[model samples]
Target: MTARVLLVTSEAVPLVKTGGLADVITALAQALRQQGVDATVMMPGYPAAIENACNLKQAGNLPELPGGPGTILHGVMPGSDVPVVLLKTERFDQRTANPYVDENGAEFDDNALCFGSLAHAAVSICAGETDLPVPHVVHANDWHAGLVPALLRMKGITGVGTLLTIHNLAFQGNFAMSAAADLAIPDSMLTPDQFEFWGKMSFLKAGILYADRISTVSRSYANEILTPRFGHGFDGLLGARREALVAIPNGVDTGAWDPASDRLTVRHFSLNDMRGKSGCKRDLQQLFGLPVDPFAPVLAIGSRITHQKMADVAIDALPGVLERFPRAQLIVLGRGDHAYEQAFLGMAERFPGRVAIHIGYDERRAHALHAGADMLLHGTRFEPFGLTPLYSMRYGTIPIASRVGGMIDSIVDAGLQGTIPDDASGILFDGEQAQDMVAAISRAFELYARPNEWHLMQRNAMSADFSWSGPAEQYIGVYREIAPVEAQALFDERSAAVNDSVNLPADEEAAEAAAMPEYMTA
Candidate 1:
């Protein structure tokens, strides 16, 4: 019996992506399949998700989810051949732009009801109500799919173990306690230790309390959440489950983020070759309407413009940095709060040729920003995993990032005073002010003057292995830890046959993939 996993999330890549969650789901599913886990991705059938599905076909019908009835659509991810299960219901089919939010960025009115339907749909599939076979475990992501573990226990469905991956703890699905009845949330489960949080029902708390095992995106974040600083008022509940919590870092999609083969990069460049990056820089400068100066260093911001990301600080600090480094150009790409958007727009107007701002998200432009820039300014108050910094590093763009979450785990600072120049990937700073970011970028510029040292740091950044092979097996261990004894036997047999990676840590589990090596499909 093959150990099957149903990976559930609100978004996925190449179809819909609001943040790093989508890419993680797509890549992790592909990597899991390679290690012989029969991984199937489950998500709401948004119009794009349904349309982009490869070999789409009707799988089964969902009876009565919270909102209404739905059908299960089966297919494979377009690029990665991992199986996809979509719940196509009236609520899920209605929204077109930004799955969670509307055109103006306001959340949908019936978000609780709609996501309640998603949870019910997952349980329906697992209870053998649909044509698809029951998975051994249901792997839920973030607060969007947080209700699954609690719902399973409520309905007395005991066959499947549950694992919840907290991508961002801040976005807990907290709603009025009155809405619980419409969501079919049982009154019994509403307690301080369970779904209840300060008289309101929280979807994230439900998963934290009920899931057999829980995992955060990074190891530091796992420990960080157990404290009051990063707990978001759920520290006590999370502390109780600390023993079950694990930290599994996210993997980069090399096929999509790699500089050498990325279609959106316009020009290809790699570690061995140095000529193409200059051409890419010129192309970016031309596209963004900046002066075509190859000698000028381009500092880029490729992230959401919000308080958590400290976009306000960047807006205030950039002027001083730009004035100091006279030749350094700044490129801003991403959209969020209207105030921040307007602020960035104002910035472009103030510094005409020196500062260029594109107040929206475009995949191609994001790639170009990384390919062109000398350094990326990624400052966030808290980050589960800083994938953007990793993406920039892939293009030999050093990131001057805040020392939080995965940034601390991934970036090896280019020494305090050129101490470990050889091993340094990027610069990391531990401060939370506008001046702090300035000081960090100052260090980056100082290193930038030393061309040989800067090139060595870029080489270290590009040579990093953020691929999925290692992390996939660690997820298997978490699954096996929670699995039933009988299921564990089956899982172990399959694991041995795949790569002999049954009891290995994530870093030590990178053996040859035996079962399904062809991850991406046309």
Candidate 2:
């Protein structure tokens, strides 16, 4: 039988969004439902999200959240079939405008407690202690919902299974142990290796160790995380659970992200009626105030300005890029660190119409940029299955990216593979060097100069599929494997293994360890 799944994540579409996590959650949830799987998405209601997407209707109150009680509000957002549950904490969550942010634009310290509360609420629903609907599987995304699997196992919820997915391991919520009492988590869970990493409580580790099954976003990333270099220091923990871990790549929403039907794009065009795309290019150039050079190559970028995205590569290579192609232009969007902001703004000043930088996110502009640009640049230092490149592909823009992680799996390298075919989708550089980026850009420009070759690449990109249907089906398969009948035995086996590994000889040591901050190095 198809299982009823509870999709848990810190962010969801039509609500709180900072990255690809939101897109993954909403797309997968709806896709699962369409395939006859019953799924509900639970997300925190940030002000922006509530204003933009929430259609609120009462789904009853949750009186037993950790630290105190909470009122559970429910609703449906645009483009999702899953029900959204919002947890409003009287002392913590209610005061904040965003789930992950405070007034100072800093990440709230109470993230552990906030998400732990989300897990606790799921447990309550699982135990039939509340009137909310019980899902057969609790699917937790990233570190935010990491505690769900552990909490469910601790409570011995008989019929519910937990599946923890790691979207990005880098942001594992490592919070202070002083707030342990307020978190209301059991004392037995504290340790140097389980929930404790050094002296900090790692929410990611907890999910990895305790969940019935663990999954990463991409197949290559799953292999990547098993080593010291990519594991983010949790390789040993993940190594132990290798048998339980699965790697399933994410997919994009074809309709929403596609240039063919996207309302946000300045001009819509498909593979057949390709002439309109040139119009889109002209419109986008005019909008961004770049020189209207129809022959000049346009490299579009819409990403957070951070090391993870390799903004440094773009900054360092600007001079060489300008030297190589005098007419080529670069359009950048999104915001992050101050260093990247200053670098891009400085370049725009130095190179006027050739380089345009938009300080923050503008979804409408992003759509137009994707449709209009000749190439999409994604030189990420390290990425966990970036969605922008996939969007660019659907928009018929060739992608030039660093060949690492998901980029390796997605984009084909023209250098190693030799001359790109008429049906080539993109070019992948093998390293982080600016020379590598410049060389790749040079090849792209060469192709751009030849309209015939460039159109072939565009057709190749447009022919590629980015639909969420495939990934959703794979996720449903994972959920079915952990249905109630299989979940009980899995939970018991997991509990015994953990208990064996972390055998506590005395109650005093456990109590002291629990009381001491988890992040404190021994």
Candidate 3:
């Protein structure tokens, strides 16, 4: 029988997005539904997330929320077979654009409470406490919905297993324990085995401790999180669940990401018709205001400018890279840490015409940049599963990335090893040092200097299958394996309570961040 899965995420496609998490949620939900694995996507009504809502239904109402009484808003996904729910609170109003924000462009302190409530609503749906159907399983994505696994268990609901997918371990949400009551979770549940983290309430820990099974975005990431280096202070906790941890590398929706079919790119090309790719290079150059020279190697980046992304390595190697390859040009997209922003802006100013910077997220520009660039830059400190590298490969762009997490998994196409195989995608830098990056880029540069060699690498990248079908199937296996008849009644009861909650929309912030597409960043 098909597993009825309730997928909970902070963001999803066509509604809102700020990173690969949303894409993963959208892809998995759609793919599962296609496979007859019934699925629904529950997301916060963050302003950007609700912008595309075609219609809404009052799911039900909740008596008291963290801020006050709240209402539940439900809407169906545009083209997919998934239902999305938005939690609106009477006191604070639900966020309309940014899920994590207030009027002054700052994150709300009640973010934990806000998102926690949304998770409760999903659980309520599963327990049949709401008007919606009781799901066989609740699939929680990332740290945002980490509270789901624990909240369901806290309500004494069982049988409907909770599968928590950790996209990135570095983002665990740890807040004051005082918020536990607001979350409708008892202080006793905050013990070391539960949601506690050194006297703080940890949402991520809640998932780790309570979920029936734990999964990460990549196998390497799942293994990495067991060590002190990648565990983010939760290695011990993860060690406890050593037997329960699983790795399912994320996959892209091939149809949406295909270079041959994507109209956003300047040139439409496949492995056989690569000549059109040069047009993309010219388009990229033109868009970035750089010299449109087919001979120059265009190095591109489309990620948040943060230390986590190892963007500093790119900044540090800029002078050397420019001196070594005079024809080299860089175009960066996305926003992040203030320090990195200042540094990138300074570099752009210092090297006019050679460096182009777009400070915020723009999905179309990101797609164009991925298609047009000759080589992609992904020097991250650590990655759960870097989706951009896969996106680049799909567009026939060779990648130069750090050997970590999903970057390693996605960049290295299986069975093509050593001696620049015809299917060799890109160069891998092992260390975080600037010299290492400079050397790797230098190697890519050497390859770029040779037209035939560069074309072979591009072909290698394009042939990879980063599609969601396989991963979706894997998720289905995990969902079914963990689902049992025992949890059915509990799930139904919880669903009803959640459906009975309130949802209030947040007022438009006067100083909201630029309303560019939020999906393609980070």
Candidate 4:
């Protein structure tokens, strides 16, 4: 029997996005379609999502949903033929700033109920209560859709495999135990071993305990979340269910990101012919009111200015980078954490034309920033997968990033131990200190001065295959594992496929370091 999967997410590209998760979901669904898996994305009907989706129509309704009532609208995702199902209700329609956050940058007060409605809606599709495909697998992404597996179990639904993909373990959808009854989660399932996390009910924890299998964005991150330093607080629980864990690395949305064809970039460029790059660089400089100098190194930083992204550390080290590389120019895009925003604003004022900062996220600027920059500064305390770095690499822009999580897998650090110079794609530093960041930035400038080596590195980065084809196939394997296929054709046909998704628990030393946290919601 052919495999059918329902991909439950909070966002997607061209419709809405807060980060890389949207791009990953869109790419995965498109790739899965190419490989014969009947993948359908289910997300909330934010105003943009509804407007961007093609051929939209009412699919069904969930009247007594967690948040009162919700209508499931079926349509094709923006810019793709992959089927999309969106939850339409007042809970999602009223708030427009961020899907999960309000205008004040605070997470939606009723997020538990909001996403709870999303999870319940997925169950409606799976249980054949709606006029949609009865999926063989329900693949829930991040903490937002974390309750899918638990809701399936609670409703006594069988023959449906559940897979939870942890995009970022830190943002676990944790809320008060008092709210458990509202979502219909039972007290028996709210114990420490189940969904209870530090006297709270964690949506992520519920999925980890009940899902047929669990997956993270990358192999390195899969292992990282198994420890205390990176686990946030769920490492011990994840370790206990270690046998169910797997790693599927995220892939780039090559169609939207390629510099040669991207509609957002000022000038198109390719690996063989990089002549247009200077024009794009000039446009970038002029866009920020800086001198249009072709010789100056333009370093781009595009990410949310949050503690997890080392925004605090960047505030301290960026001034030193400006002083050390007087001719270098910096362009930053993304918004988060007010203090860091103010700090960058102050730095821009002090440096005048040399430093420029864009306070919020914009698709056009994001594409231009990568296409024009010589190098990208991406220092994350922990990364599920380095989508920004990978996107920059596709544009022939090298990255100076932290040596953690997915960055370890994606970036080939120059002059670092266990790395070959000819294959080095970017610069990587291990420490979190400002000095370490400056050291990495310093090394990038040194590499930039050598034209031949820098060009070679850029070519290597541009040529690297970060597509979704490989990872999507691995996801198919995951679906086939617990899915009740009527025929043996799936196994017989895919016998040649590599079976490398397994990730056994790390040793005791690694397990001791496992932990999780709730940064939002009390």
Candidate 2's displacement at residue 157, Å, is: 1.0
Runs in model 2 with CA error above 4 Å?
52-55, 91-98, 102-105, 416-418, 486-522
Q: Which 10-residue window of candidate 1 scores lowest in summed lDDT?
A: 513-522
Going through the candidates in order, what is the number of backbone clashes in each?
0, 5, 40, 12
Query: What is the per-residue lDDT of model 3 for residues 1-522, given as tens digits with 9 covering 90 to 100?
Result: 345788888888878877888888888888877777778888776655556765778887776555466677788887765777776664234565556655445677887877777777777776776676777888998778898888787777886788998898988888898888887888678787778888898989988888998888876677667667778899888877877877787888887888888868877988888777888888888887888888878888898888898878888987789877888988899887777888988988988889898888877888889989888888888899989889998887888888777776667532222356655788877777899788888888888777787777777788888787777767766675678855433222322221100111233221121331131112
What is residue 76's positional error in candidate 3, in angstroms? 2.1
Model 3 bad stretches (over 4 Å) = 90-97, 101-106, 413-418, 486-522
Least lDDT summed over 10 consecutive residues: which range in candidate 3?
495-504
Per-candidate TM-scores read 0.93, 0.89, 0.89, 0.95
Q: In candidate 4, residue 479 scores what lDDT?
A: 80
lDDT of 1 by residue, 1-522 (tens): 799899999999877788889989999998888888899999999998998989878888876678788899989988778899998988888868788888788888788888888888899888998889898899999998999999999899988999999999999988888878888887877877668898889999888888998888887566566657778897788777767777888999888898888898778989999678998899889889999998898899999999999998988888898889888899989989899999988988888899999988888888899898999999998898899999999999999998777887899987556455568999987667788889989888888888988999999999999998877878887787677666876554433322221133434323322221221000
User: Quick one: ranking by lDDT, best first?
Assistant: 4, 1, 3, 2
Q: Give a tens-digit lDDT track for model 4, residues 349-465.
A: 999999999999888888889999999999988998989999999999999998888888899889643334888899988777899898888888888888888998999999999
Per-residue error for 252 in candidate 1, Å, reads 0.5
